[model samples]
Target: MEENTDINLSSGKVESPSGRDDGDKFNLQRKIFVGNISYRVKQHQLTKHFSQFGTVDYCYVVKDHLKKWSRGIAFVTFQDKKSMTRALQATDEELMLDGRLMRVAPAEESKRVSYSEGANWQTRLPPSLPTQTQDGDTCESDFHCSEQVTLPNVSHLELDACGECAIQRLYDDSLMLIFSFLSVKEHVRVERVCRRWRHLAQKSWNRQHKLQFRHMFKGFIKGLTDSILNSLLQRCGVYLRALDLSASPQLLSDLCADSIGANCPNLTELNVSGASVTDVSLRTIAQACPKLRGFIQERSFYVGDKGLTSLFQGCQSLEHVDVQNNAGIVGDCFHSLPTTVKYLNLDHCTKLSDLGLRKICLRCKHLTELYISHCKSVTDQSLINITQNLKRLKVLHMEGSYSQITSSGLKKIGQLIFLKELSLSQNSAVDDGVLVQCAVGCSNLTNFDISGCYKHVTDLGIQALTRCSDLSYLNISYLSHVSDSCVEALATSGKLQSLVARTCSGITDRGTSAEPEHLDTSRSSVTINMYNLSMPHLKADREIMLRPADSSSEEEEEKEEEGGGQSEPVSLCHQSVMAAGAEITSDNEWDVNELDGFECDDYLIGDDPLEEERWSLS
Candidate 1:
């Protein structure tokens, strides 16, 4: 019998005829044989091309035994037999290999001559069948075959079949949705990827409805001019609902304002705080944007009453306005404000007096919140007017305005049963009388601040505040008269979430502790006659330790020595009343050190003061 060359079709190698079972050889037939491959193609390149159909296990390109050059054939074995079947079915037409058409089919076995053993050598042929020439020599070319096969034309292939083929299949809307999550800076970086990605990123950026220029400081200094603002407004301003240009103060002028007014007609909210805007720019924006609802122009020195008048007269849909520190607004200009306004802030407006406030309360009946802190000219009459006219008021801030307001003003404030948040800090005349009135009527109160009113606030005031079942935030710092009794009263409220009582020397550790310990007075219980009749009866029974005298002050030491070395207890009298009387002369001069403890820093270090039954309201 003629020698039959046994070839391993999976590895493209020849083996000697042995007693191996036919089942082992049949299992190796799950590899697809690809032919007509170019000589430049490598094993990895072949595997990469075949991986698109299924997961390939191993791929090998057959080579000559002596010359070590490619034989223009390769075998690709898949992980499963199903992958081999799918690969054969998917490649119905000619497969492209490095710009050339190739043939793909099931691997088969054939006989061939092995060059390593000369004429006597017998081997297996690759996927293509070899033919013999008329010169009595065996060849590997298929030209001598009976049937002819033509190659495909390279120019007729699809253009997207080569580079980045996977990503090119995504639709335009899908691409836009993927790019919309990227920020402005990331969008700029993605534009350099390719022409298609750049087009999609640009389209998504142009459709943005909100833009904040707060972090573009360097760009504002170099490129944000009037022309740039005008160009930006002309491109995407029509779709913008919120625009924040507060950071670029130097670039915002009348020209930029005029461009925004002409282009952004659908804008509902605008922030130009700390910008160099004048009355003309304000009037232009107000006259152009009829749908304007919320405007913030804080710290703009050049915008006066005329601009405010124009804005209120033109924008009937206005609901919120913040013009803090605009000192040019006089009492007469408030008449132009519409009754549709609900929230108004005129903090630090020194020109506004009781007359202007009364006018606001009478005209804006729909107002629910008002902030007039540092308006020194406002007195008790303003609060009376607010309670009588603006029945819908809920939030009021009158801190730092105690020069004219007295305890009588709080009586009118208590009548507003709908009040939820009230801030009367730095008002020297607010005492327990005010708290008594508030507890009787203001049942809906949730937030109260009486910090700096050290004159007459005592434990009795906090005890009276327990009637407000919804009280959550309380600030009574700087009140020297507040003692452990006030803390005890607040602890029992069962709804306090935040409590600040710093600078109150009367609150001992026993009051702030969650679990109080019994005092150990058995060691130094001394009976002495109490000469100070002003001391409370309960304090006189407890053992008191006198503080040491100041050695740096010679007068204090001499006085203590003259009293036969007997130290006196420091008086617990109110510190604000003993001196020139606690008065806030300037808003900047307010002592921040006394109020810093009222923040959340202390709550992070020690136990929270309001940890039990604490709750917060919206």
Candidate 2:
């Protein structure tokens, strides 16, 4: 049987003016009855209203479950003696409600068999608390994960006390500024110090926070769930400034389509180096992080022309881009990039050509460093255009088979005046005269590469380079006309550190045959001496195998479809699989191979084959 416990809240015992008891008893601590509340009255509403005069310790609204009715009274506990005194002084005897004079006087504690379990008040439980199961066992719910991970046995009072202890130390302006530059991982460690430290870190994070996720992709990706990120941001009240998602292009689409963007409005720096992201992903980034300043990704991340256009138009604040090995990026794409971009790396971009380079030099005037190494299609016109337009251009790299460039083109490059490093290796047109012209035009040149400019390069070229007083590193390897005189001059150049002149037939103290000698007659002989002499780092070697401009082979036809032309004849140095100092086989093999005897000497070394009739030039 349940207790039918009731307190006479209305009729409290009062003493007469003479100080005699009126036979009715009242207990101030047990209850101060306040009446006429509906069952719908929530604890938060009651506490808010009652706590105005004094701090409220607890508020309980009694309700009957069977009939779903309010008990018409609630218990309000004051924090201290002063609070109780203030409450009495501020209120009257009656609380008028529902057109009746409700009671507001202290009442005696209920003494029926037991206290009534009448309060239907909802407990002020933390969000991370466990839920009761059917077997009476408490199991943690998803919401409980955060609580379980937090300090044990922590209560509201303890939180308040701990928070107070940390307030003075954290609110110090100097400490706040000190945490400003800390990385995201370091910030996490600070927050885990103690309950007070955690609260302090949270306050600091909320006020002003920036996350440096540099090289943290592995750990971030492991636990980077939508729920966790959203929860952390919302609770901590922070905006992410730098989000280094380098090499995480695969997550961009998923993160954007979800509410990640809406939650992280302050994102600025982004790095996505290797995840082959497409145009759609870049567009998504533009929409999500409107204030984004820098974005980094590999070429495979872009989808098509639309992707390039979207990034250019959307990320107006963008300044730097590092796109390596992206074959699809063409010359036309330069027009889309923001003018603010100062540093650009299009390294190993095979499809990019001088036309695009010309576009970049003209539009992006502030560009200082341009890296186009291993981009085989760059020509003299492109280099000339860059030198003329970009006055501030400092470093230019055109390494790998720039054979089409002539002395006149290099002379034009000297116009930059401030050009620091110039690389034009494996070009058939480069010779003593070209080197002389380069040395005269660009006196500030510190680094130079005229490698693989064989046959015509002589000691005269080294004399011309003497004018470049600042020349630091020079590569003149495979220039068969160079000898002890040029090497001695380079050795005394004072600024020269590296000088590559390996396999230059002209460098021999004793004269050798101009014609290449045979290594072995057998085609499959692995031990052939000629194989050892095959030059390394020579682009002409690969070019020789490429089908000639007029070849009718299927591979050539395919290359034409891909690159859109039958290009000029290419000079090739054989990659030797023979012994050192071995001679090369006869040029007759050229007729049988896929690429026939269309030679670089015909167009470059000798007089114009076009000047004479088809038979006369030979």
Candidate 3:
């Protein structure tokens, strides 16, 4: 037997490790035998061709033992089981080498080789063959060939295959079986591996009836280079039914609108809140998206009468219009909307008076939900007009401007039996006299917020509101004059969810002021309180500050002292009654220090009449 030779496949060198072929014979993953190679095929060339499948680090073409001539055979050693399998799959016969095809198959055992020196050689042998001797020759007595073998036994081959071969040849039939048994969450994890996998994992975000644009409000238009915004609008505008551009001021401007008009013609829901838009932006939006149903404009976007006219003219399908924080909008804005307009929010529009609201009631008869909070200009007659004309109105919010609505106004609203939600908070003018009328008129009322109406909100107001059988949510906070009895009635009468009654001194069992501790302790508290008191009260509290009375010479001396300068509280009584509201006013001639508290003066008015003559020069 010739000693096995090893070759370095990467470098193509016939290199052998120390003590080769004795105790450390290389383990073969597949049977390795070489035969029928053309005479020109070199070991290096053969190794290079077969090593494409795996590492063939060692290979040798055998030559005649005596003459050392090419014997048309070679031994190839594969680096790993995978390489061995790949070689088997890739080539069974005629693997080209040196421009000549070679016949390839597993090598058969050498019939004449001796292996009898190894222990238990008899049991390891083929059934009829006996063990061989230690030398290069076989043991003749037991080595007789009884029958010819058909093929080599490759049943124990441990060759590892490449990915494509492993999946197609080894696992193709059972591939679905493996994944069919995995849990849903595990499948999701597998699909989250890369872009391709994520594409497979998610369902359609646009499959629903209405595309949800709420979550996209936060960061959709951030630093989007002008080109990108224009491109996106061009691509996605046609199919878009709802486009909520709320909170995106830059993207809703004139430039964006023009681009959108050229692209998005079917847009239905357009929310461009905080855009600070004028009639121009609205006109562009209305023209671009004629099918628009809902429109939302926040604080900065003042949708005056002209914008409303354009919107009503262009977007006839409009259903809801929210013009919040446009304090300058008069009643004329609502005149343009068709009767098809159902929902209107004019919250914080302080300039819209009763006249404008009456126009709204007359024109927008289909109005179901109306929010006119903080419209201090609206009066009871206007609200009466709404209750009488708009029968469909259900949810009404008139908080912060109660002076407009009196008891008679509540009586008018009684005609709308369909009323559900009502808010009268911060309307100090609404007393128990009117709220009882409201409770009687709108018996179906469910949600109510009646905060900050202190002077007039007595227990009678609370008792009347309790009459609503459907009442569930209520807020009666900050009514400083409301007593414990009102809260006790609410705790038992209605189903309240949230109530904010800050500074409601009368209802809270805790005796502290409802104002925040920080606000009460701040510098403005003392100043604000003294500024509102009567002139008689300031004279009564003479110890707090001095008052200038009748004495021309003493006054001149005090003026001289004041010219020298000192920080002093302004005088609260006597001569300066013109400054009744308690604003700080000190001219260059009247130094702040020369004012009442700076220095003692004989001209100072107080309970003691005789002390008015003594001037403290110090």
- Cα lDDT tens digits, model 3, 118-210, are 225345444233323233222112113222222221111211211111322112113334433444334446444433223322321122223
* Candidate 2 segments exceeding 4 Å error: 1-183, 189-196, 206-242, 247-269, 287-293, 299-301, 353-355, 402-411, 425-429, 450-458, 475-481, 491-618
| Candidate scoring better on lDDT of 2 and 3 | 3
Q: Give the winner by TM-score.
A: 1
Candidate with the larger lDDT of 1 and 2: 1
TM-score head-to-head 1 vs 3, winner: 1
Q: Which ten residues in a row have the lowest lDDT in candidate 1?
A: 112-121
TM-score-based ranking: 1, 3, 2
391 Cα displacement, candidate 3 (Å): 2.1
lDDT of 1 at 603: 32
TM-scores, in order shown?
Answer: 0.57, 0.49, 0.50
Q: Give the candidate number with the greatest lDDT.
A: 1
| Clash total of candidate 1 | 0
lDDT score for candidate 3 against the true structure = 0.59
lDDT by residue (1-618, candidate 2, tens digit) is 123322322345333432223353332343344544544567777677667657787777766655657655577766543454455444333233334333233333432112222222253221223434344433221111111122223334434533443333222333445555566566667766444446546556754444333465575456344454455556332356665444334444444323435666666666556554667766776776767676666646455556766777777777777776778777677776778877788887887877788778777888877888777677778767887788887787766655566667766766777778887766566666667777877889888887776756788987688788888788776665677777666656657655555576556533322223532336742331333444555633455556586556577678878999775544433222333564557631223232245464333233332332333335
Q: How much does candidate 3 score in TM-score?
A: 0.50
The RMSD of every model to the true structure, in order and in angstroms, is 21.0, 19.7, 19.8
Clashes of 2: 14
